[model samples]
Target: MTLKKPDPSTLDLSDVDWQVSTFESGGGGNCIRFGRKGEWILISDSHNPDGPPLVFTKKELEAAILGAKDGQFDHLAGLG
Candidate 1:
């Protein structure tokens, strides 16, 4: 089944239940927040909650999470 992408401009972010990762405790304001609304997964900077969030489909978010777990993006963080 194919999921339709949501229009970010039409999304009301106020309704999203944003959450920070537990592993980010005491990270000194450096972290990302994630939330979900309908069929979209939302990601935004924790330091700027009022800023626009990046939206993704379930599968897309899953792939990103898997990649992170595999350290595919470690280079971007200077870890690889």
Candidate 2:
């Protein structure tokens, strides 16, 4: 199924600095992410309008993404 675009206001741009990419994650979930020189945040289940946006600081997000790229996150790939 195709996901309808979510409302614009829901994106947490509080500290976002650049576009990472709008793509599907491990669980086949769709998310829009932003990346800084050394960081990124993958926004998931964004259609919901509650709770804090999942926050991943630069180093942490970088590790996760890098791990996936280098096959270190093979098991975790389908996770976030």
Candidate 3:
């Protein structure tokens, strides 16, 4: 079932249990961390732990995961 996308303005993430990806914890560069707030996923850069996060719905997150697995975003590495 598809869920409605939430309004980004209404989110309050003051108590999120943020976690790092296993790969990132193992000394991976370009590290990313994520947390959950209801059905939305919150992503942030590990290098800037206190920075603002990018929010994504579960569906959007799944699409991003698949795209990454398929190397659709490999070119992003060169942009750094």
Candidate with top TM-score is 1
Tens-place lDDT per residue, model 3, 4-58, is 7566456777888988766644464557878999878989887876677888887
Instruction: Predict model 3's lDDT versus the native.
Output: 0.78
RMSD of each: 2.1, 11.3, 4.0
Model 1 over residues 27-65: C-alpha lDDT tens digits? 686689899998889998898887888889888999999
Which ranking of candidates, highest TM-score first? Answer: 1, 3, 2
The residue-by-residue lDDT of candidate 2 on 1-80, one tens digit each, is 43343344565555555443455444444445443322334443443424344555555676877877887756654644
- Candidate 3: give the clashing pairs: none
- Off-target runs (Cα >4 Å) in candidate 3 are 1-10, 24-30, 78-80
Q: Write down the worst ten-residue block by lDDT for model 2.
A: 35-44
RMSD of 3: 4.0
Cα lDDT computed for each candidate against the true fold: 0.86, 0.49, 0.78
Residue runs of model 2 more than 4 Å from their true location after superposition: 1-29, 32-42, 76-80
Comparing candidate 1 with candidate 2, which one achieves the higher TM-score? 1
TM-score of 3: 0.67
Assess the local accuracy of residue 24 in candidate 1 as a C-alpha lDDT between 0 and 100: 57
2 against 3, candidate with superior lDDT = 3
